[model samples]
Target: MPVSPKIYHGNSTPSPDAELAALIDAHPKPSSLSEYSYGTAGFRYEASLLPCVFVRMGIFAALRSASLGGEEVGAMITASHNAEPDNGMKLADSHGGMLDAAWEEHAVSLANAPDSQHALALIHTLLSQHTSTGDGGNSSKKKLPKMVVHIGRDTRSHSLPLAALVIRASRAMGATVIDHGEVTTPQLHHFVMHANGHMLPSIIPQRCNESGYCEIMAMSYAALLRTGSVGGKGNVGKQRLHSTSTLVIDGACGIGALKINQFQHIFEKLRAEGCTVGLPTLHTVNFPGDGPLNDKCGAEYVQKQQLPPRLYTPSSKGAVSKRYMTSFDGDADRIVFHFEDEAGKFHLLDGDKIAVLVSSFIQDELRCIDPEGKAVKCGVVQTAYANGSSTLYLKNVVKTNVVIAKTGVKFVHAAAHHHFDVGVYFEANGHGTVLFGPKFYDFISAADAKLRGTSRHNRANIALRRLRVLPALVNQSVGDAMSDMMLVDAILFLRGWDLSTWSKLYSDMPSKQAKVKVADRSIITTNENETAAVAPAALQIALQAAMDDMISQESSGNGPKPRCFVRPSGTEDAVRVYAEANTQKGADTLAYEAMMLIYKLCGGVGAPPQPLITNRL
Candidate 1:
């Protein structure tokens, strides 16, 4: 077990009133407030001001919960892999997902509410309604029990104090609270669903209208049904005869361990029910003090050649030699799969492979159920970061439409919701999600209906309930490790295919991504004049000219055309450089050469002193 860090406070503990006073005193007059804004990632600010930003976030959490019938709320305060100074807040509903856009707008309205008192009053009213006791009078009709709010933070230094402020605010509002210290966002979601003593009964006389409850109920049913069906049909007996399947989980020090444990426990129960369960056997890397692995250790770091021994060893004669391996990043919201081939070689199942496998599975399964066998009308969406091979595979091989969007899970998620029956999106970084169309949801729900009023449905639904547990999914959604694991498991289980086999479908182009910390985050931007304003105009011109020259030379087709995207880091005061080409050597050459040019134009190879420049590039 890892030793937890001690919570320390400065000489003085600041009260909300005192904290507000101090903030006002330090900042004095209010700036226009236009500088602070919210996006799909949520409200972000420098770590120095996170204390104040959290106060605002708390208010938003309360308001959103209130508007949604006073359900419980949660907030995440750590920037995933961003530099120390960058921090952000994600406000989650009771289900652990982002609040709907309308709710976000409402939160913004409350945040910008004309006066402080008005803002505070609006928050107070919502908190009161969510937690209100049915004490006499007409209020009884509308009053509800105090909502329970769970708060979790990441590894950043500022997360603890910021979390403290959030906890204090919830307690102040009379809402019951759970502070899951140092948990990954996905672990928090798992805690929200399966953990005991985590849920509080609603005080409202009317039945609670939580959006996630039905989803949870359905998941529980799905898990039970699937397990029972396998056990009842003697699938486990056949599995026992053949030997239990083995799976290796590499939790990249993220919160996904909890979900994997849940799967293990659930599988154990199935094994006891005469199902042949094999190994869960989790190998955790990147725990505290182990040093940061970042992209190098998790899915991004896994190359085709790195196969763990457990996945390679054969069990016995006449037994299937298939073994599975998966790894998750910091929060366990995304995942990548690995497997060993017959020749003892390892292979990676990148997002493209996952998309191909999932798209095919959905299409095939739906066709089996639908007599017409008409196309499912589903499309696959990806970002510029997607491998060129993936695009060709989807169109020519799978014969499905592919839509490429800008980088970011937000855009991908939105595309999934709006356009297709089954929309798949992934960042080459390994973040992905499968948006089940209403028809698919109904199909699954209907399949579940056949086993209604039985333990089978109840057990199976536990697994299925995960789909409805969106608050945690949404809250931890951005590049989450846990959610990704659960998602991959669900899809693989449904498809009944080895994830490793899917990676062999196509070869990927070599790619590389690097980051350079600039003196000022504001100095780097896609905006032309605004970016020039922060850095020297001459330097900007030189950098642009150099990039253009590189693009032109690379486009000549003597070698793989090198492509690069240079922009300011959203989560840090740095410039990010991403380059891809036909070969690893070409990709590295382009990145290195670009960095050299930028550094030369700026005056030196190393970062400037006072400006505090650092380059992972």
Candidate 2:
């Protein structure tokens, strides 16, 4: 008989306390125990199997603490927004970012070492030598080492247990652990800096007088406030501002609700001071009674929801009720927002919107601050899946340099570190990360110092200046919904512009993506050659010929040629089809037509079936 599945709430599956105790005692041996193989995010593993991974991670944390002047290390084990089947682990640095590539390579090597005994010995030696002498290899100052590691998880069923495993391991390693419980990825990152003995600056704006000049002054004051200072502080003198922001948060019924609640609290406090805060009213549909809220109801499933009433018209007057709706996956790391027009139509604001908002805000505000200033030129780094419109807008409209990297957060993180000041990369499925340049940090610090020196009356003016610059500072160096929300809010609020107006600023080209799940996981792509396995080279040539024929039939040869990238899905047993064109109809037509041609090449199996075509922005 097929066993019924169990369910749990508040970031974990329902494992009976007795069952959990039994499972802990059984110690179901993992396929293998390895060292912390930290990646872009950190050490990740299947949650059910994470206890084993945590054992390895504990040793690694001890090693990292010893080597880095006795600083504590941490682990993150939620899959961000991946499906339930997938889970991962990541090792966070003392600074809250993931370990650098060199360190990650070292960790991976340790994990893949031939002998576990040898790996443990190496870890032990590293820890002993570093911790014993307070010498981080070359440092001579006896650093009053205060190492704090903040750990949290999103709403994945495995998150709680996985987080518990991490907490247990960190404590076992003798590191003081602050269990943030369920929090957004960005909030976790923010806590890292905020809790690390750093006093962030806050902005306080004076009430807007009838002269509209007060509003301008208030806006400027808000702008001047340092990004990190606003939320951590208890109060910002009363101008009584309600967020005036209405967000339809598709919480995915995951741990995102925790983060969303934090945002609500922030807005609520602002509302108490007098700001109009609106929340995305949730209306559940197609939810299963027995199953946990882990399905497509949140951001991933938002494309399928009924268009909210506020988005119906583009030109409807009286504040058109600008609404920003976002959904996070099973874990709250990934985010995708929806903007409604006056016509009650929904539009997706994916990584492209992120790029657009970040780029436009930086360009407009920085120019206002100093027209001829040669501050570091901000750039947007994205994956190939970025919408054609985004690339064009960043280049022509925003005039920011853009770099296209491969998919995955690691690649984005690496590119952000290497190339740009503000790297914005998001997968078509809505995973994203942002990188902020060091110079941006310095600028905000200087502005904050100026504010600190001013008197109370001038404090509001200082706050205004900081507010103008807050968008650049508060945003996380990683892709996070909370950070993205704050970024979007800062941009639109400062400009008093609505989302539809901003989205219309640039025309987006049409793009379509298709997923094909294969029955056999062994049918993997080797060396990027899609036709390597087919017996006859002629068959490969034939497939290419078909794609070429389609491309040749294009009507307008003006823009870039039709682009398609076929690859195996990273997280699923399937193949993915991505096609982009100048027009949506054209993109869809070409995609479907190409699928047919490819299907014919594959012995007419019809390219492995898939679920409905999810219209992800």
Candidate 3:
């Protein structure tokens, strides 16, 4: 039985210490299981094992907010591409990014406490650290600032109950919790960042609500469309705006679909008032209840299989005449675009393509704004998983500096923030965002002020206006499918380019990704960039020999040579092998061979993995 809060600290309000003890007693970790460690995202497991974890995390979120002097922190309940039975939670720091690395260890300690006594002790120790200390005085007497936690959830059936646990635990710790129910992951991030004063209301133009997200997106998009391109680049008139077929979005049958529908309604409302230009019609498929989330659709499916979603199969009746389509993951934080060529073959424009295109456009804009390259510096951050062709094009063709970061969005986000004036980062899996440094924003503001003297039709004036509104068009705190789609559309309209034109900019070398189940995935490790395996010397040696053999076999190919790497997956119980080659067959063979090698070398779980069957002509 759970202890009532009123029973502790006397009267109605319980003391923090007493309340914490009661909460810990109410939710205890299983002694039979090993300690849960926070991973690349956060705590994830079967929904059945998470109720206790949520309570502890909720209390920790409150502690984090108090530690930050009452700055708003966020707790989002989502699995993000995982099956419905599996759910997870990730905490956002005051800046609205992933939890700070320094505190991840503390999170582990709190979640792994053996019993209620140990848990209470850990909480007390953490609480003492956050209190003021002076002249050997007792720190426990000092009162901490009021803590605030912003909570959001996805459409998972278990998500609401889990969110309720978080809210209850947070309030028990004497923190105020604001519940934003059924929001996309990025929307919650946007709310926290906006509430904490990181983004200017004048620039973003949103009030931190569902409607606010749409308002800011619509406003920025309209601003960009109204400003004609400089030089001979075409302006976005009515015809150019709708030149392409209706954009069909595969929503992965999750919360993103609902959010897209809401955005569409908002767009239509704004269109009627003439506050926005008419753009291509957005038709969303696989909405909630259309099917189980991410069964055979979503960005992950399209990017890995290199096929259209199940609903948009080549022979399916739902296939549109449009040359382009896009898909959003469960929570709408990631997006990827795909299209069919004249031969009815599918082509995916994964995150690598998005990074190249966006960076290239920004590069051109910066050069146009200042040919001397003095105002801003542009750089792109990619993971080892990035297609080699994309890296080559970015370096040789885009004429920009490219840096490699370890896998995961946090690392890339950090690298982009530290490396350049305008940092563009994206994973090949379609999770990405653009970050504009303070210096870049300052430059744009100064340019806009200087161009005030010229007519709005001046090329420089138009370019400056577009630059000024670009940041608002992006969800700077995180990757947002809605924001990213708008940015891509605006750029395409400005450059007078279409899907085929974008695809022709650069070609992707064929690549394959496969995973092998292992008894213990942690036994495998890799270098900082994750391009090569480091641990289990025998495994590394075997992988190297395999990669060497494949490269030697493809040395005389027409395109890029073969490259391969095997790394342990952060979110699963398997080691993932990725191989790239000049031809699709070579890539597939290398991937299959490597997977089998890992399974044989390491402890094999079930049957050995099998290669996927492709029916493409």
> Which one is best on TM-score?
3
lDDT tens readout by residue for model 3, 492-557: 877767788898897898888888999999888899999887887787788777778878877745
- Candidate 2's residue-wise lDDT over 1-617, tens digit each? 11111111111224222322333343434555433445446655556656655555544554565566645345555666455665776666655566656666656655554444445445444544645544442122332233445666665666777776655544444455666665556545544533432223232222111122113222332333223233323223222223334555555656665444544444344446754322222222212122345454555555323233222212331233335556665555566666656665677666677677766766655554445636555777777777767777778878878877766676766777688655566665566655566665565566556557555344343343543445333434345665455556555554445566566776566677775555443343423223122433343454455446556776546555666555555554555666776666656665665555344443333344433342432
TM-score: which is higher, 1 or 2? 2
Ranked candidates, highest TM-score first: 3, 2, 1
Better of 2 and 3 by lDDT: 3
* Candidate 3 deviant stretches above 4 angstroms: 1-12, 30-32, 133-142, 198-202, 229-237, 241-245, 275-278, 312-322, 556-559, 608-617
TM-score of 2: 0.70
Clash totals for all models, in order? 36, 50, 0
Q: How many clashes in candidate 3? A: 0
Give the winner by TM-score: 1 or 3.
3
Q: Give candidate 3's TM-score.
A: 0.92
Task: Looking at model 1, report the run of 10 residues with the lowest lDDT sum.
Answer: 201-210
lDDT against the true structure, each candidate: 0.52, 0.51, 0.80
Choose 2 or 3, whichever is better by TM-score.
3
Worst 10 residues of 2 by lDDT: 1-10
